[model samples]
Target: MTRAGRPTRTVLAVDGGNSKTDVALVREDGVVLAAARGGAFLPQTAGVGAAVDVIAETVRQALAPAAGAPPYADHISAYLAGADLPIEEERLRDELIARGYGGSVVVGNDTFALLRAGARDPWGVAVVCGAGINAVGVSPGGEVARFPALGRLSGDWGGGYHLGEEALWHAARAADGRGPATALADAVLACFGTATVEEAVIGLHLGGLQIARLHALVPPLLAAASAGDPVARSLVERQAEEVALLGVVAMRRVGLLGEPCEVVLGGGVLTARDPLLMSLIERRFAECAPHARLVVADVPPIVGAVLLGLDRLGAPPEAYERVRAHFSGAAGRAAGDASGEEVLTAPAG
Candidate 1:
């Protein structure tokens, strides 16, 4: 029920990753009315049945309030992080529909959602460097392609988790004096609030420190490298090269990189202000893809999820800019409007 005496049409948008799941309900005009979030739903991390349950629970929580609220939840859309294969998509979609969302569910990988946020041409590439890394390519012919992401063993790299692990490995080696001495040894010691690498090691062994916490070392390490630290410089260069390789591989998979193409970069590392990584990535991409142009995406991943929902409703291509505009405004936006309640707000710049 609305002040206008009409039912508020609503769409549910969800973004599920290995760490957490987020769901939100938005009006057709893009105003967020309600949101909810839940735990990890990666089938590989949590069992398939468990992942399905988490997804269902998150979506239900977001829609549950709509039953009696002014806005009524109707259609449902989801962009999930590990739902890469068709079977995964089918299984999740079936479960969502069976759970009462029925017939109005749109399910896809996070890569697809990110692509929707960055490019309207449908023939562009999207590269993300988050806890993990992935790339998606959309052809003008409505065909979409993605490369197999085999975590670290694929010889492919560049992601927060991977980079964090790398930082730890470097520090461990440097501490053991088995590797070249660099500013990283001092930086790592300082990051763990310790006076020596031995203290940091003791903290790591005692479970007081986390592997992911090493991600905090990345920016300073990159800075040290930019200031001429060989070890730090090498790691940043390798990450940049690998990310660029992923973009090239994805473009080749979709058959659209040689002559003219667009590469959209998203995620934490790429979004950072470091020019070394971006510069190296550009140099690599230029050599591999020739005419490909790498650019930053205007919309974040949440907006990508919203776009996928709109696409499910058959919204025209022109809807992208409108939706982007709607969410970009402030003042009237609720406390947790843009991102769902579950999303941890990154510290402000």
Candidate 2:
């Protein structure tokens, strides 16, 4: 309800990534009202029906604070990691409608939200490389294109997981005398402290070692290449090239590269302070997409989801900034300890 006693329209924004799900609520004027976070609900990782349950539950919790108020139905915009498939999008849309969100729902892949966050302009490209890699671009006329990212067997590649795995693979080959000796073998072996590469592999499956543990290997791999390890050097170079290629495809598909457009970079790997990898990516972009500038996303993807929710309500850019500033200040108050509601309230512009 408004201070003048009139009803207000509310919307929910959600970002479901490979590792986490974050949801937020906002007013038409753009103040964030509430927010929450949970686990990922990608059907590819969680099973179709199970993923639906996770998403439904996450939504229920996110909406609980304001549910049952006037305007029983609310607007909702969700960006999910594995909803690129139409069937998946349809399933989620149907579910949202059934849950009474009605004529207020938008479902899309996670990459699109990152793109929207980096550039509100209609035509732009977004490339994300963390545990995985993918790219997407949209044209001013709403045309969209994406690259196939089917992982190793399909040569669908780029990102930290693949890079770390490649380092280990070559290290094992070198240890077995089938390949030239490189510093990666010694570096990775020290990472695991196992006498052999085979033992390190076995220890990974024994389960107490968190998968995040492997994230530690990425920097050393880059360091090895910086120090002139040929295999590691080639691996980083190839991965950087592939990521750049993905960005180029997005820009060209949307007819934005030769013109004015922003190519946004997001995700953990890109956020990492690796000078070599960063420089290589910038160099490739200079060659393949001279007109597209790489902009770092200003807010996390969930905030992008919130902006998306407001966008559906026709909120102006100033409206977004007002609320964004509020949230930014609020988040700063408590820093890392901010709760979901606290984070939402931070954007009280």
1-349 per-residue lDDT for model 2 (tens digits): 5534656667777788877888777777777777777777767766766775666566667678555532233687888887766777788777766666535788887888888766656468888887788889888898898755667654677688888888888888898899889888887778888788777777777864555566667889989988988988998899789878988988887787788677777888876646787778888877777776677665677766777777787775676775556555655633332221210001111
RMSD of each: 6.3, 6.5
**Residue 128 of model 2, lDDT score:** 88
Model 1 stretches astray by more than 4 angstroms: 1-9, 18-20, 28-31, 35-42, 48-74, 316-319, 330-349
| Model 2 per-residue lDDT at 270 | 79
Name model 2 segments beyond 4 Å from true: 1-6, 56-73, 101-103, 153-155, 205-213, 330-349
Highest lDDT against the true fold, candidate: 2
Give a tens-digit lDDT track for model 1, residues 1-349.
4425656456777778767887767765566766677988687766667787786677667667544422234677788887867777888877777666534777888887777666655468888887788888887777777866667555558787777667767877888888877787888887888888778777878887775587787777788889998888888889877787878877887788766777878777877747777777777776677777666665556677877776666554555555566555532444433321111111212
Worst 10 residues of 2 by lDDT: 340-349
C-alpha lDDT score of every prediction, in listed order: 0.71, 0.73
